[model samples]
Target: MRAGNVKRGVVGLVAGVVFAGLTTFSGASAETGGCGLVGTVGTPEIGVDDTNAGLETLPAAEIALPEQIYFRTSTESFNRRWSFAARDGRIYVKEAAAQGGWRSLPLPGCMEGRIAGVSADDDEVMAIDRDGWFFTMDHALSAPKDWNWSTRYGTPLWTGAGNTLPAGTLDWTWSVLSPNEDHVWRDTAGNDHPVGGAKVSHVFALVDGGCRIAYVDPWLPVDHSYELATPANGRFRAVKLSTSASTTLVVNRFGDLYTRLYDFDISGADKVFFRYSYEDQRGLREAPDMLSERVDSGTAAIQLPAPDWVRQPKVPGEITDRISVHKTGIGSDARELRIEGESGGRTGYWVKQLTDAAWRFVATDQPLAGTRLENTAADHSIDESIQPSPYSYAGRSAAGWTATVANFDISNTPTTLRVDVGNGERLDLILHMVDGLRQLPQQRGIGTQARRFDGTVEVPGDILGSLATQPDSIRQFVTSTLGGRRFTDTAVDVTVREFRIDGLSVTLGRS
Candidate 1:
């Protein structure tokens, strides 16, 4: 398994499939106070996970730092095998020759062995193979004390050690040779540690998924991808709760949190739950108020459990003014989202800037704006799970406007789908764009932009929004009376974290 000096091949264009999970995350709170919740834009500090002074909330998203986990370890090491994930644990790096060899780490390239499987947070490790090529690495481990070589793709996993590459940020393209994945420090597992400890000398091994995005200090011009509302004075507006019966509700935002799901009115959609945002962190706060401008007052308590059919009476835990929400509100739902014992998923805030912050990856065709998440389908549920089944959380029969769908479509939108609801309770995410299914291409979605988009397509004030041009049936709406509201406020809980039905003068990526 030792034959890679270099092997690269990436030219994708299928458009669809995503999902995720996390137990404890830190960044959130850009603004969204009046108990309406929803922030993101210049800054809106103040964290919460259990607010309940009045009700209605879903404005939480923060924690995006140092992210580079570990990469830069190449020589082919047993050919190729490396995986990573950190918040607490998870790593793989196969090439063990034989023997049980499932849980390994002794990579240096040129070939070694040991990289089994299994790691949460949505998980990814592709390789594709055949010729089209395959390589997707991202679930980091940690290692960026700065170590410069010159720069093509190395420095900035969080940078430190030696430091280099910051000149223009280096886009480089078309590498002739000398690329990446050297993560350094490899005693060969003989002992120097790192077979599992020292965090495996900085994780990195993603193909097709390419994984590697950390390092955003480009002088901070700002535009890492934004769009936030409901926190000017605060009325809260980042909702979506699930249980799935079929009322609809899609909501999708990425990076830090705000992912919802639900689809099943008669099995036509049949996808019960896959949520995000359930805040109930207790005396939360330990660090993270990134502060651009936001330190509001009042509202922020959660413990939801209203009886009488459930209209918003929770009391499981939560209360906030956010000091740091106990070190960024600790969270974890492990077991890969166990309905039986595994875990679910949710890790958002719109992040994907590899090569370090200086951000640059726009090219599905480039030109097209963004925001394209059409809809349709009265009932839909998927989870063909032939074997490994441990993900479940989109279920509720009478929890007030509920929906937790995304068993799996692959039509696109598979970061792992997320949707949790438990704060002031008032989730009616009913995303029923009903019509064809998929026909993408207000710029792009399916073929000429076919159909079949499930959820996550929020782009109201974004003009340059590009995917192509946007024009797939065109029909955008988000009324609870825009913000006036009548009966659709819950202070938080509506997470889909990334979706697109496509085709309708589309173009999003502003905020």
Candidate 2:
């Protein structure tokens, strides 16, 4: 094997050791209040194999000196497991080797040179060229063995023209900036062009003046959609901007940190989903027909209400060294904000909740040690119902009587039904009757309105039989004997469209 080939195996081993040493030294130095003496550490040089055959490998030394690293949060495929690093205007990639350590992969031809910055999410890797153009490679694609500059990276999908920022934009500690794959566009020729992963929905950068934002309107024509704005009326001269999902953290030049929640009004339709119960009343008992109230329905974005910029309590005598915000997982709304600061040459760490007003000091050498952020918001509850009147059915025959329950024009199916029986037994049913509702073709122009469930439910024959023999009224029989049941739903745990249940009712019939 050539020198480069030999270095590939050796690099993985050495890189692991070097990283371990660095981590140990950092922890020790922080605990001892910077009393440790350390020699000058030189940047490790990577040996690039001249022969471009099979999977390319790099010297282990270079792996430790990355200016920035991008990690993919997917395990569906080998390519999705790949992680990227930016160093000296080039991109290096690695993945876990089946046997154990990390193995270097060839740099994509398009990402070989002039790579200014790189970021990744679960789906794709977004890169910025020296000329301010943006390129991306889908993480779902197979790993490339040899560099094919033209074929690998493809043409710059997003031109940075008119989207330029001030000097030092490249050095900003940005959070993962991935493209919004959910947004797509169609050309005049009717060709459906997927929204470029490089055309991120929002770009927050640290400019010379302060922090600036570039918002890309996915609905508008691509050439005319870039809109730039200053956040919080440019109140603070921001030195860093880190964004994850709906939350953003801003660090000003003076080391003061602030955070805010923001979400674009992508869809105009505002609808709410909830569950409700009806009390037994006389008027509804006299009626035997299906009753419903018409409600406006449409699709809308999921956003926690945006609040004013909230300043986090400062870390006493600490100079901010680095900051990061990460979502708990893919498709999660909760976030963790971690800050690393240095005081008197000793490293210290702090953590704050995304929606909190206080920052807690973490007495650990490692960042984010033992810290786990979770979504604590309560789920959307059902709170609507209709009352039914009392009706004695002592003389009526139970053989030909039936009961029907329904919820029409709903956004989502109720997941559970809790029945409180007179015998004090609580029965819970996992409703799957509305599963077919989602499979039906949706009506056009209806705006997310769908008929979830509208049919008779299985009531115990004994309950209906008792109605004929016992002197209990229909309302008493239905509520106490038949058992009072109500639909329950948790919006966060399930996919919810925008719309209220237009019609929810239960009807009794006698043949």
TM per model? 0.18, 0.40
**Poorest lDDT segment (10 consecutive residues) of candidate 1:** 333-342
Stretches of candidate 2 exceeding 4 Å from the true structure: 1-63, 66-83, 94-105, 140-201, 216-232, 263-308, 330-333, 343-345, 360-511
Q: How well is each residue in 1-511 modelled by candidate 2, as lDDT tens digits? A: 0011222354345335433432122212222223221111111223223332443445443445322222121111122344555556676555523322333434444345656665544333445556544444442123433222211111111111122222345233223322232232211222222221232233344553453443322112222112122233343455456665434676654556666544222111112111111111212211111011112112111211123355666645454535666555332234667676544445456676665666666543433221222212322111122112121111112333222222321222222333333344433333322211121233321233432332212334454445455334444545543354432222211112222222222222211
Q: List, residue by residue over 1-511, the lDDT tens digit for candidate 1.
A: 0001110110011001011111111211112111111111011111222212211121211222122211111211111222222211123332222322223222222111222222211111222111111122222111111100110011111111111111221110000000022211111111110000011111112111111111111111111111111111111221211111111111211101111111111111211210111233234331121110012112221111100111111111111110000000111100000000011222111112111222112112112112222112211122122222122234432323223434322221222322233343322232322111111112211123223423332223331133134332121122322232211211111212322323212211111
Strongest candidate by lDDT: 2
Assess the local accuracy of residue 340 in candidate 2 as a C-alpha lDDT between 0 and 100. 61
